[model samples]
Every structure is written in C-alpha cells, then in structure tokens.
Target chain A: MEIKKTSLNKLHQSNNAKFVEFAGYEMPIQYSKGIIEEHKFTRSHSGIFDVSHMGQLFIYGDESLTEELEKIFPLDLKNLKQNCSKYSFLMNEDAGIYDDLIITKIEEGYLIILNAACKDKDFEILSNLLGSKFKMNLDNNRSLIAIQGPKSVEILNSIINGVDQLNFMTGNWFNSDNQKLFVTRSGYTGEDGFEISITNDKAEKFVENLIEKGAKLIGLGARDTLRLEAGLCLYGHELDINKTPVEANLRWAISKSRLSNGGFIGSKKIMNQMQDGASQIRVGIKPEGRLIAREKTKIFNDTDKQIGEITSGTFGPSVNGPIAMGYVDKEFSKVDTKILLEVRGKKHPANVCALPFYKKNYVKGVN
Target chain B: MSEVKFSKEHEWITLEGDVATIGITKHATEMLGDIVFAELPEKGSNVEKDGTAGVVESTKAASDVYTPVSGEVVDTNQAIVDDPSKINEDPEGAAWFFKLKMKDQSEMDSLMNKEEYDKFAKESAS
Candidate 1:
C-alpha cells in the first residue's frame, strides 16, 4: 500500500525526524533527541505532535440525529452538553467494540475524531447505518496538532489567549488572525494539554510557532509511551471487534443512563456482562524483572495454566519500569495477583496492579 | 599492537593476548535508541562464532547480541545488566558486554580491522 504524507511532512524531515510507517502514513517515530528524552521532556515541559492522520468526521442533520446516533452506539448523547467532548464506543451486534471515538457536540451537529486506520471502516459503517438520517462530512483539508504536558498551556497561551482557561473535555473555537481554530482541552497523554484543528494551509506555520515557543517536536515513539503510561487504550491493541468495552475495563465511558435506557446496539449483552461481571477483565501488569514482556506474551496462572495474553506492553519512562496491560480471567484479575508471563520460552513472574501505571496529571475544572 | 575488530552484525571485538572484549558498535547503539534492559551470557559458557550470546532491549524493540568469534565466556559485565544505559553511554569501552578466551586464534583474521570496519559500518548504514 502506498503510504500517505501529512502536510507537515517536510517540516518533520527538516527537523531531523526518524520516519516509520504507521497507519498507511510515513510518520516521524522520533527525532534526534530519541524516545526516552522526548518522553521525559513531555512530562516536565511541553511537546508538539502532528496527529493529522486521525479521521475527523462532522455529522449534520435535524433534531433526530442525536437519537439516531444513540441507537448506533452505546453513548448517552442526550446529556452531552454543547461544546463538550465525550469518549464513546462504536459497537457491533455481538457487543464487541468496532472502534472508539471522541465526539464533541456542536451547535449544528457533532464532530467525531477516530483512529486513522479505522477511518474508512468508520465512515462506511456510519453511512450504512444512518445514510438517510444524517450527512457525514469527512474533513480532510484540516490538520490536527496536539500540544501536551505541564507547560503546554503556558507555551500555547503565549500565542493564543484564553486557551489557558479552557477546561478539560471542552471544545470551542478560538479566533487567531481571523482563522477560527477548533481546539479541545484534552489529549491522550495524561497531562494538561490541548488538541488544535487547523487548516492545512496554516499548519506548517502554526507548528513552527509552537516549536518556537518551546514545544519540542515529539513523534509517535514518545506518543505511545505517554499514552501507555496514561493507561489509555489503543484501538487495535486494548480494543478489538472480539472484545467488549466491559471486558476492556472501559465501563466508565458508558453512562448510568445509557445502561438503564437500554436502546443502544448490543445493550443486552453489554448490560449482562456489566451485571454478571465480564468473563475476562483488563488489568495492569508489572513484570518482576527488567525483561519487558511485549504484546502477545502469554500469561499463566499458579499451576502454570495459560490464562491470558498481554495486549500492550512497553518500558514506561515515567514509571521507570516495564508495564503492560492485558486481559485475564476475571477470577485472576485482582490487585497484587501473581501471574507468570511466558517470554522467549521462559516463565517470568508478574503481578496484576492498578492501572495508569503513572498518575494522571490532567487540568480539569478549577485545577 | 592489539587492535579492535568488527563483525558483519555490528558487534565489536578487541583482542588483548588471549582475552577478547566484546561489545556492540557505536552505530548499533544509535540505531537501537535508549537501552533499557540487557541480558549477558553467563561466564564459562561455550559459544560459537556468530552465535547469540546475549540480548539488548531498547524502548522500541529487543535485539540479540552475537558473538563475533567462537570462545569460552571468561567474564560477563553485570554492570550493563544492572543498568543498560551504560551501553548507550560507552558501548565500545566501559560498556563492553563480555570477555572471552578465543578457541582458535586463526578466527581473528576473518574479522575486519579498524580501517576496514569504519568503511564497512559507513557502507551498511547507507
């Protein structure tokens, strides 16, 4: 498959970024500073990431759009306030998760951001389900950039005003030199950050401006570690068509109203799992030693019985240890449960622990 | 004078009389990024030329460390295992992975010397 390039490709090359193929795009995995340096910098300072590859879809329709969307997803759009963002799941009939997305309710319609690799599939699903009910507009002329970390607000606030006061999970338009920039005070990294959507024509200059203001250019390498440390689930890893939200430990995204309302797709199976407790549950795993157990590493029980497998694993720089997230039988999924990881034909000891291997440092309301 | 030698897989070996110190080349560390974990072969283990002796893991992936020549492991550097970052700090010197006693002295002729290995490293990168 031919790989696509973002508008900031030239800028990344000029900045000495190491390129890697990701989601059909040749993206920078890291710069000269390397992943560890970039990861640490983002924790203490600020970092800018070119997330243009993500799919941005705008849904427009009449008053019935919300009800129609709620029927297709396990989301509670009724209480979703205007200009607020909510994380939701796109589920199939089997109660399995098809994709995960962030939906922002606007005045006229809704803006949804999804994973890049799942963009075409998501659009096709939306069209097939609600083709006559809503108009789906895929925004390709815009680029998305995320400025994240502790100093993100200070760095970005220096260029655009009032962004420092934007609460987490809130989306609004800010005018900059007559350009209406849609920004959300949220990010994948467990930090105080903002994701800005700008036109392709102005993306290069905007990124250059952020770098000039001390936002170091980070790549996908550090981005993975940051999100992993935040305990955020990547679509293909922590979520899959065969896995339900309740099994992935993402029940928080489903509100109480939706569970009781019981009209969404796969609501029956989802509620059943929630009530009876999922057969398997996702939990954090910390390996006993320095050997990092990567994805697909099998997990074993006390009697050496294979119980589960790791879905996502990496060396978390902030945590200063190897951490992983995987699904295990609900009976063995508990804090401080001893588990064995089969790595390279050897059984290494590990323990199930609380997630978010590192503490989240989000800038919520009044924080 | 004893001199440094290089293998096709980017490992480096330096012979000082009967003992040979082995470590990865500077180019290898740069390509691997930050070194997070390292597993070295145990002392007194018999290994063959181009055989996997240890493993070095970076944040991105893990790579096997191959022995440049057949030998018996005399001493293993536990420092790199205790703190893998040392390999990134000084891959050719203080971070030498292991020391071995060469089984056959004739094997040294097959390895590339300083001048030849420099050109080889540069060519392989391109």
Candidate 2:
C-alpha cells in the first residue's frame, strides 16, 4: 500500500521533522529539537498535533438514531445534552475492545473521532449493526488538529474567538476564516486544550497561523511521552481485542444506567466482569530508578512467577522518571504494591502508582 | 593522549600507553536522541573485540554499546551511568564509557582515522 501523507506534510518538512511510518501513514516522529525538547516546550507552552489520519465519522440521524446507538454503546445518549462528548469503546460480544473513541452529540446526530488503525473496521461494524437505517460518512476531507498545553486556550481562542467558552468534553461549531470549524475542548495530553476540526485544504495555513501564535508543532514521540504522563491509553497498546474496558481500568467510561439494564452490545459480558471482577487489571507502574521497561517486558512477583506484561512504558519527561501502564494480576494491582520488571534478563524493583504522574487543572464542569 | 580512532560500531578510542579510553561519537549521540539511562561494563571484566560492553537508553529505545577492541576492563565511567544525559551533551569527551588494558594493540591498527571515519559516517547515514 502507498504511504499516506497528511495535508500538513509540507509544514512538518519545513520544521525539520523526522518521519516514521505509522499505521501506513508517513508521520513525524520528532522534529529537529528532539523529543525531550519538544515535550518540555509543550508543557511550558503550546504544541500543535496533526491527527488527520484518524477517522471523522459523522452519522446523521434523529431521535431514532440516538436510541439505536444506545443499544451498541454503553453511553446514555438520550440524557446526554447536545454538544457534550463522552469517551467510549467499541467492543465485541466478549467485551474485548476494538477501539477507544470520543463521541460528541451534534445537531444532526453524532460525530465520532476514532483511532486511525481501527477506523475502517469500526465503520464496517457500525454499518452492519445499524443496517443502513442511519446515514454514515467517514469523512476524509477534514483534518483534526489538537492544540495542547497550558497556553493552548489563549492561543486557540485568539483565532477561533469562542473556543474558550467551551468546557472540557464539549464541542460547538464556529465560523472562522470564512469556514465552519467544529471546535472541542478536549485533548489527550491532560492539559487544558482544544481539538479543532477543519477542512484539509485549510490545514496548512491554519497550522501556520498557530505557529505564528507561538504554538510549535510536536511529533509522535513527545505526544507519546505527554499522553503516558497523563495516564491516557493509546488504542493498540493499552487497549486491544484481547483486553476489555473493565480489565483495562476504564469502567468509568461506561454509563451507570446502562450497566444495570445491560442492553448494550457486550453488556452481558461487561456486567459479568463488573460483578465477578476481572482476573487481571491495569495499573500504573513506577520503576525504582532510571531503567525503562519497554512494552512486552515481563512483570513478575517477588517469587519469580510471571504475573503480567508491560503494555506501554517510557521515560516521562515531565515526571522526570520512568512510568508505565500494564495489566497485572488483580491481587497485585493495588497502589504501592511491589512488583518486579524484567529488563534485558535482569529483574528490577517497581511499585504500583497512581496515574497522571503530573497534574494540572482542566477547564471542566460546563457540561 | 593519542590520535582518536573510529570503529564501525560508532565508538571512538584514544590510547594512552597500554590504557585506551572509549566513548560513542557525537554522531551516535545525535542519532540516539536524549539518553536517559546507561549501564557500564564492570571493572576487572575481560571483554572480547566488538562485544557488548554497556547499554544506553534514549527516550525512544535502548541500544547496546559495543567495545571496539578486546581488553581487560580497567575502569568504567560512573558519571555517565549516574546521569546519562551527559552522553548526549558531551558524548565524545566527558562521557567516555570505559578504559581498557589492551589485550592486543594491533586491534587499533584496523580502526579508521578521523578523515576515513567522517566519510564512513556520512555514507552509512545516507
């Protein structure tokens, strides 16, 4: 297959980005300043990310559409106010996650932002489920740009004008540069930020305007460090077909009302897991020193018995230490529980720690 | 102090009498990015030519640091192990990985000089 490039490919080139093939797309892994510098810059200021490879699935329908979606997702769509968004997952009958997504209620129906790798499969699943009763469009004409960090609000609001009023996990449409942009107050970096949906043709100029406003373009390397520090899950790593949302420690995303009724797809398995408790559960890990336990590193108990494996691990720039997230035996998933990580044939001490190693205030509560 | 010699593995070696100091070149550090952790060969250990003598981990990944020539490990730099960022900051100077007592000094004769190494580095990178 031909490697795909985003509309901002030229802009990334101008910034001296080092490209890497990600999910079949030629994407920047880091710029010339490198991952550490780009990470620090984002934490101290603003950083823009090009997420155009993700699918922007707009399903147009009315009240019936909301009712039908409730049968598939665990969210209470009827009670959800317009413009409000919820973090959710698409799952199989056994409750194994297919993808983690953000779905927002719009005037027409709903807008779902899906992971790049799983978008096609998710669209197919949804199409088969809905059976063509609702109009679905996995629009490729739009680009998703996320501006994150402390200074993101001020920088993005300067151009969009009304984005500051949007609360976390909410979105609204606004006219900017004679084009309609769907602006949302959400981001993966756990900072007060916004994700702007705009036309592909306007992406380059729009990003240039952000660079002019002091927001530098960060690449996938820093993006990984930032999100890991924030304790957010990446699709293929932290959640996959073999992992359930309950086992992944994301049961909070499931609606309480739906849990009791158990009508959603995979609801039976989800309810059973919620009651029986998953044998293995996800938790944050802090290595004793500077040793990085990369993905697939074996996790062990004090007795040398293998308990689990690391899913995502890295040196968190803001935390100034190594942080990781992985599934461990449910008995060993408590905070401060001692565990051993096997790196390069040597066992090292580690402890289960609370996530979001770095904390910052988010603009929420409006929804 | 002697003229620094380059190895195909990206290590630079400088001989002073029977003791030779070794460190990764600046180009290596540039390629590796911000190094966060380091492990060194133990003192009094004997290593074979081109054998793994240490490990350095950047933010992105972990890579082995190989010894360019066989020797008995006389000393290992604890400074780089204590703070690996120095390897990226001053890799060729303050970040020398180890010092070895030469097992066979002829191993240095096969190494590249500064000019030959510059060409090799360029061609290999391209």
Candidate 3:
C-alpha cells in the first residue's frame, strides 16, 4: 500500500529531513539537528511537530449526547465543562480498551482526537455503537500541528493575540489572517504547547509562519523519546485492547463519579479489577549501565525469575540516560526496587523509578 | 606507509605493519544520525573478519561494528568510549574504535579501496 504524505512533506524534503514511515504516513524522523538536539530543543526552546496524521472526530447531538458518550467511554462527560479537554478511553463491552483519546467538550458538541494508526478501527467501533443514536463526523481533511516547548506561548502569542490568556487543557476557536482554527493547549510531549487543528489547505502557510518564528520542526523520533521521558503511554506500547486504565497507571483519568455509576461499557469488569487491584502495573525503569533496555527485554527478579517485559525504551535526551517503561508484577512496582533486564542473553541491572523521569516545567501565565 | 581498507558493513581499517586500527566510515556515522553510546570489545579479545566486534548505538537505533580483518584486539580508543560523539564529529580520524594485530596481510585484499567504498556508501544511501 502506498504511504500517505502530509502537506509539509515537501518542506521536510527541502530541509533534508530523514523520513520514515510511521502509522501509514511518510513522516520526518529527524532533520540535520538530529534526534538528540531536537529533543533538547523542545525541552528548552520551542519545536513544532507535524502531527497531521492524527484522527479528529466531532460528535454532535442534543443534551443527552454527553450521557450517550459516557456509555461508550469511561469518562464522566457530564462534569467535563465546555472548552475543557480530558484524556479518556473507548473500551469494548468486556472493558478492554479499543483506543485511548482526548475528548474536548466544545460549544456545539464533543471533539475526539485519536491515534493515527487506530483511526479507522476506532471510527468503525464508534459507528457500530452509536450510528443511529448520534451524529458523528470525521474531519479527515484537517491537519494537526503541535507547537511544543517552554517558549511555545511566546511564539503562539505573536501569531494569535489573546491565546496567552487560555489555561492548560482548554481550547478555543481561533481566527487568524482569515483562517479558522481550533486551538487547544494540549500536547503529547510533557511541555507547555498547543495542538492547532487547521484546514489542510491552510496548513502549509500556518506551518511556514511558525517556522519563520524560529519554531524547529521535530520528527516522530524525538516525539517518542520525549513522551517516554515524561512517562506518558503510547497506544500500542503501553496500552492495548486487553489492558485497562488501571493497569496502565492512568487511574487519574477515570473520574470518581464514573467509578460508582458503573454505567460505561466495560465498567463492570474494569471496576471489579480496580477493586481487586491490577495484576500487572506499568512502571519506569532506569538501567544502571549505558546499554539500553529495548522493547521485549524481559525483566527478571534477583533470582532470575521473569517479572515483566519492556514496552518502550530509549536514551532519553532530557534525562541523559536510558529510560524505559514496562509492566511488572504489582508487588515489584515500588520505586527504587532493583530488577534485571535480560538483553542479548546478558543481564543488566535496573532500578524501578517514578513516572515522569524528567520534571516538567509547564508554563503557567500569571493569574 | 599505512593502507586503509573498507568493509562492506561500512567500517574502515588502517593497517600499519601488523597493527590495524578500525572505526566506522564517515558515511556510516552520517547515516546513523547521532552517536550516543558505544560498546567496545575488551582489549586482548579475538575477532574474525566480518564478525561482530563491537556495537555502536545512536539515539534512534543500534548497529554492530564488524571486524574488517581477523585478529586479536590489542588496544581500544578509550577517548571514543568516553565521548562517542567524536564519531559524529570526526569519524575518520580521532574516532577510530579499536586496534587489532592483523592475522593475515592478505585479508586486506578482500576489502574495498577508498574510491570504491565511497561509491558503495553513496549507492547504499540512495
């Protein structure tokens, strides 16, 4: 199958970026500055990401629409105020996750953003569940551009006035230079940033403006390392249909009201599992040696018994060491607990560490 | 006089008498992007031509450095081990990985010349 190219493909090529196929899209993996430099740039300055491949879905209905969504998702949509965004999961009837998404409560309806690779499957699942009951629209013609870094606010403020007033996790309809945009102060990277949903036709021009303002274009390679350092979960790696939020260390995303209501799909199984405690819990691992603990590397106890497997691993630019996330037995999930990662038949010692290996410095405007 | 030979895996070897110094080609380092860490074989270890002698890890991926000629590892560049980015900065000169005592001088005949290896690197990139 032919891979899809984004509107910024030409720009990436002209800049001599190394391209790699990711999630069915031919995207830039890095540029001349390379992954380490790009990762550091986003942490210290500002970096722009071409995440246009991510799926954007809009749900519209009457007053009962929020309640209807709560039935399919595990989010307490009723309490999610308008213009606020919440991370939630769409689960199967058995409580296995279908996909994790960001649900933004808009003025007219709900805006759901899903992983690019799982877009088609998630659309089919939502259609099969809420086809006749609600109206759903997939905006495939739009593009998502994430401007991330500590200086993101300054860069965005120069382009769109009053955006600095918006707080984290809130979104607003933005009008700039005759272009309409849905601007949200949300990002996958654990930095202060904005994900701007723009029309495909206007994406190039918008990206050019940001680049002219000194926003370096980062690729998926840095994106992975950044999110991993922040201890954020990726869909296929840290989460799958069989894994619940409880096991993924995302219990905070589940609202207290929803826990008692038990009205959403998979709630019976998920709630029960929550009460009993999840058998496997996701934890961060920092290797003692320079050798990285790559994906599928088995974690073992001191006696050499298997405990878990690494889901994601890399030399985190921010942390300046090899960092990884894996699922281990609940009893072995304590911080500073020593474990061994078997890589290439050799055992490398590692320590269980806390989430967000790098402390995030999110920019907060003066209140 | 020293004669430099290239391996198909993009490693370069400079032979002076029976001593041979090895490192990844400048082209290979460019292709690998950023050099973060390297795993060098211990001095005195045996290595065979085209065999995995060491490992070079970039931020994005890891690659094995194969020996261009069979020999025993006599010395390693601890400077590169302490600062692997030297490979990215100067892949040909100061970034040589290790030194080996040549087992057979004729082994150099199996390697490519500088011009031939340059073309090979270009073709592989495209």
Q: Pick the candidate with the highest TM-score.
A: 2
As a whole number from 0 to 100, the lDDT of residue A42 in candidate 2 is 88
lDDT for predicted candidate 2 compared with the true structure:
0.93
Please identify which of the two predictions, 2 or 3, would achieve the higher TM-score against the true structure: 2
Give the DockQ (2 decimals) of all models: 0.87, 0.91, 0.82
Which residue pairs show collisions in model 2?
Answer: none
Cα lDDT tens digits, model 1, A1-367, are: 7899999999999999999999999999999999999999999999999999999998996569998998987777888888899988888887888789999998879999999989889999898989766778889999999999999999888877888888899978888867889999999989889999999999999999999888999999999999999999999999999999999998998878889868888899889999999989999999987879899999999898999999989899999989999999999999999999998788999999998888988877743
**In model 2 chain B, where is the ten-residue run with the lowest total lDDT?**
B80-89
Which lDDT tens digits does candidate 2 get at residues A1-367? Answer: 9999999999999999989998888999999999999998988999999999999999999999999999999999999999999999999999999999999999999999999999999999999999989999999999999999889989998999988889999999999999999999999887889999999999999999999999999999999999999999999899999999999999999999899888888999999999999999989999998899999999999999999999999999889999999999999999999999999889999999998787965897643
Per-candidate clashes, comma-separated: 0, 0, 0
Q: Which structure is stronger by lDDT: 2 or 3?
A: 2
Q: What is the lDDT, from 0 to 100, of the residue A99 in candidate 2?
A: 95
The 10-residue segment with the lowest total lDDT in model 2 chain A = A358-367
Of the true interface contacts, what fraction does each candidate have? 0.83, 0.89, 0.78
Taking the tens digit of each residue's C-alpha lDDT, what string does model 1 give over B1-126? Answer: 378888998999988888889999999999899999999888999999989999998899889999989999999999998889999999998999999998897888999987898899889877
User: How good is the docking of model 3, as DockQ?
Assistant: 0.82
- Using lDDT as the yardstick, the better of models 1 and 2 is 2
Badly placed stretches (over 4 Å) of model 2 are: A365-367
